[model samples]
Target chain A: AQTVTQSQPEMSVQEAETVTLSCTYDTSESDYYLFWYKQPPSRQMILVIRQEAYKQQNATENRFSVNFQKAAKSFSLKISDSQLGDAAMYFCAYPSITQGGSEKLVFGKGTKLTVNP
Target chain B: GAGVSQSPSNKVTEKGKDVELRCDPISGHTALYWYRQSLGQGLEFLIYFQGNSAPDKSGLPSDRFSAERTGGSVSTLTIQRTQQEDSAVYLCASSLGVLGEETQYFGPGTRLLVL
Candidate 1:
């Protein structure tokens, strides 16, 4: 079984500042995918970034990036130049990718992020 | 191109009653997924459908929960004898195919309340 953990239940950051959300997972599989999803007030989940287990280099998407430490099973999200729009519930997830394509994502309890003006 | 969409954006039913939620995936998408999000909690996988493959119901919490996809396009999640604890937002997502790195686009979700 695979599980993801987000230690922080809630977080807040001032506008223009940077924030980091921590995530850790337990997986016996050597290959997989990790993702950070953002659910805004509209409740539509938006993918923030993704990291491949085999990639030693972390993933970065503009102001959003991940600090992926495979050895530690740690994948954290860093938000730079935080804006009010960034306020949302962020979730860390690991999806099981089977050869048959019958895969499901395991998600951690979310962290509610508040961006202060 | 439209993204995934779920019908009956909000559903209210009494305990012990049955409820059905529908999801319409993006055209040409061969993979569909169902997930439940409790209040202030993260998503819990429910079921998955891909092409002609057998659906994965491993994540279903109980026998009362079941899901079916028609023609690999639209899916329905049915809950028999609903419980108040079943109250949550039911989300639907779809992907182009089963590629390991394909992104799953999500819908706004159907808010189900079992009173």
Candidate 2:
């Protein structure tokens, strides 16, 4: 079974500052997908960014980026120019691709990010 | 709707009672998924459905849980003889296809409370 871990339960960043949330996972599969999802008070899970294990180049989406280290089993999310709108519960996910061409995601305990004004 | 939707937004039921949660996916999506999120915890996969194919129940925690997708556009997760431990937010997601790299769009989720 694959497991994802988010060591930080909560994190805070001042407005205009930057913050990084850490995540790690254990998987024997060489090819898979990693994603970072943001859930706000609205309880909607939004995709923040994603990284493919076969790609060494990190994935970036405007202010949101990811540092993916496949060898170390680490995938961290970096949020730049943090704003109050960025405050949310961030989760790291790994989806297992099965032989039948169907798969499901396995998520880590989330890290609540607070953006302070 | 432009995105996935679930209802009732909040449901409270007594232990041993049966509960059914619904999910409506975006039009044209070929794959749908169900997940359970406990308080202050991450999302756990429950089931997966793809275009008239057999559903995946591998992630279901117990026999009490079952889900089905109708017409491949809407899904319902039913918990028979629900238990207190079943309290959690049930989420639904849909993607254009069942490919591993496809991006999934999520619903707001249904908050289920089994008392």
Candidate 3:
């Protein structure tokens, strides 16, 4: 079984500033996928960014980027130019690729990020 | 035209009563999933469905919690003899395929409360 850990239970970032949410995982599989999702007060789970384990280059989407250290089993999400809309519960998920087309996502406890003005 | 959708934005039922939650996945999507989120439990995967294959109900907490996908399009999760512990936000998601490697699109979720 795969386990994802988000050490920071809560984080606060000044609007327009940068913030980093920490995440670590335990897995023996060489190939897998990592993702960051945001759940706002609206309770909508929004996909933020993703990183493929086999790829050395980290993944970035607009203002969001990941620092993926495969050996360390660390995949941290960095949010730059943060906005008020970014205030929400952020979760780190791990989904492994298997033989078939089926995949199940495992999520961490999540960190509540607050964008302070 | 796109994105997963769930019904009964909110539901309240008495303890011991049965309740049903619905999910409508994106058209042509071959994968659908069910998850529950509560204050005590962050996010838990309950089941996964693909095409006409049998669903992976391994995540279901108990026999009272069961889900079925009809025609591989829509799905319904029924809770028999609901309990207060079952109160939580039930979320539905879908993806292009059933592969665990694919990105999943989530619905807003249905908040269920057992009184």
Candidate 4:
């Protein structure tokens, strides 16, 4: 069983500043996928970004980038130029490629990010 | 209609009552999934449906939770004789099923509150 662990329960970042949410996972398979999902007060799980295990290059989307260290089994999300809208519950997730190929995202206990304005 | 949408946004029922939550996937999306979120439970994988194939019930918490995807577009998740522990936000998501590109688009979840 693969499990994602987010050590930070809550993070505080000033608006226009930067913040990084930490996440780690345990997986025996080397060819899986990892993801970061953001759930705001509206309760919608939005896909922040994703990284494939086989890829060595990190994935970045606009102001969001991931620090994926496959050897260390670490996947952390970094948000630059944070805004007030960035306040939300950020979750780290793992997705298995096998088992019928379902996108069953195993999420970690979220980190409540507070963007101080 | 533009994205995944779930109905009965807020459902409140008694402990022994049954409740049904519906999910309308994106048009033509071949994969649909159900997950539950609670304080300590985090994200609980309930089930997954791909096309018209047999559904995966391995992630279901117990026998009381069942789901069905009709015509591969819409799905209904039912919890019978619900318990207090079953109270959580139920989330549904769908993807294009492009194999390696498994980008899942989620819906605004249905918050289920069992008294």
Candidate 5:
């Protein structure tokens, strides 16, 4: 079974600083995709960034970036120059293929981020 | 273009009553999915529809939970005999259904509270 794990239940960072949310996963499939989603108080799941397993280059989207280590099976999210708006729940997800051949996102418990000014 | 949208942004119901949640995916999206977020379970996939056919109902918690998508655009999830444990934020998402391009756009979600 493929499983995603976010060990940190909560994390805090000072505004304008950098914070890295940890995520690890175990999957037997050689080809897959990993994603980081942000859920604010509005309850909307917004896609922050995504990384393909086949790619060696890390994915970066403006202030958001990922440190993906395929051999270690670790994928962590880094928020640079974090702002008050960056405070939200961060979830690491792995799209795993089921036995029936459909894909479903397996998500971690999530890390609640607090950006303190 | 509008993103995925869900009706009844918030619903309050008593236990044992049936509730229906609706989702309107992005126009032209062939794949739709339903997910649940609760305090205990965090987030879980309930079901997904590929152009009105659901090949993956494996994530549904029980028989009480069911979903259907018609015309490849609108989808509805019905929970029979709601339980307090069923209280959670239900989210809907849509994708192009193209292989290797799995980015999904999500709705704001419907917060369901069962009393």
Candidate 6:
């Protein structure tokens, strides 16, 4: 099976500063994709960034980026120029194919991000 | 374009009663998924549907939990004899269901509170 792990339960960053949340995953598939999702107090989950395992370049989206280390099985998200609105629960996920041939996302426990003014 | 939508933004129910959560996926998307998020268990997949057919229901926690998608667009998740542990935010997502187009767009989840 596949599993995602976020070692840090919480992280804080000053506004305009940068913060990085750690994520590690285990999967036997050689080709896959990684995603970061943000869930705020409103309970709406928004896609933050995505990284393709086949690509050597790290994925970035405006202020959000990822440091994906394929060898170490690590995919960490970096939030630069952090703003108060960036405060949310961030989850790292990857797709896994079930025995019945359907794909499902396996998610990490999540890291709560707090942006301090 | 409208994103994935879920009905009943919040629900409160008794322990033994049943509850139904609804989801409307993005238009033309062939794959829909159900997931649950709770304090105890971060996030878990519940089921996956492709074009109104469920190829995988393995993520369902128990027999009491069941889901179905119809018209290949809307889906409903039903919990029979709801329990306290079933209290969580139920999320729905949809994608094109084709390889290399697997980015799933999520909806604002339905928060289900079981008393």
TM-score of each: 0.94, 0.95, 0.95, 0.94, 0.96, 0.96
Which portions of model 6 miss their true places by more than 4 Å? none
lDDT of each: 0.91, 0.91, 0.89, 0.90, 0.90, 0.89
**Candidate 2 residue runs with Cα over 4 Å from true position:** A97-101
Residue-wise C-alpha lDDT for candidate 4, range B1-115, written one tens digit per residue: 5999999999999999999999999999998989899874468888999999999887888899999998989999999999999989999999988534768899999999999
Question: Superposing all C-alpha atoms, what RMSD in Å does each candidate have to the true structure?
Answer: 1.9, 1.7, 2.0, 1.7, 1.3, 1.3
> Mind giving the per-residue lDDT tens digits that candidate 1 earns over A1-117?
578999999999999999999999999989888999999988899999989999999999999999999989999999999999999999999986433446877789999999999
Docking quality tier of model 1: medium
Q: State each candidate's chain A TM-score.
A: 0.94, 0.94, 0.93, 0.93, 0.97, 0.97
lDDT of 3 by residue, B1-115 (tens): 9678888999999999999999999898988989899983467888888899888777889999999998889999999999999999999999987444577989999999999
Candidate 1 pairs with clashing backbones: none
| Candidate 3 stretches greater than 4 Å from native | A96-102, B98-101
Which structure is stronger by lDDT: 4 or 5? 5
**lDDT per residue as tens, model 1, B12-111:** 9999999999999999988888999999788988888888789877778999999999887889999999999999999999998753578989999999
Model 4 chain A worst lDDT window (10 residues): A95-104
TM-score of chain A of 1: 0.94
Who is ahead in DockQ, 1 or 5? 5
> Model 2, range A27-101, lDDT digits (tens) per residue?
998988899999999999999998988998999999999999999999999999999999999999988754345
* Docking quality (DockQ) of candidate 4: 0.59
The C-alpha local distance difference test score for the whole of candidate 5 amounts to: 0.90
RMSD of 1: 1.9
Error of 3 at B80 (Å): 0.7
How accurate is chain B of model 4, given as a TM-score from 0 to 1?
A: 0.94
What is the clash count of model 2?
0
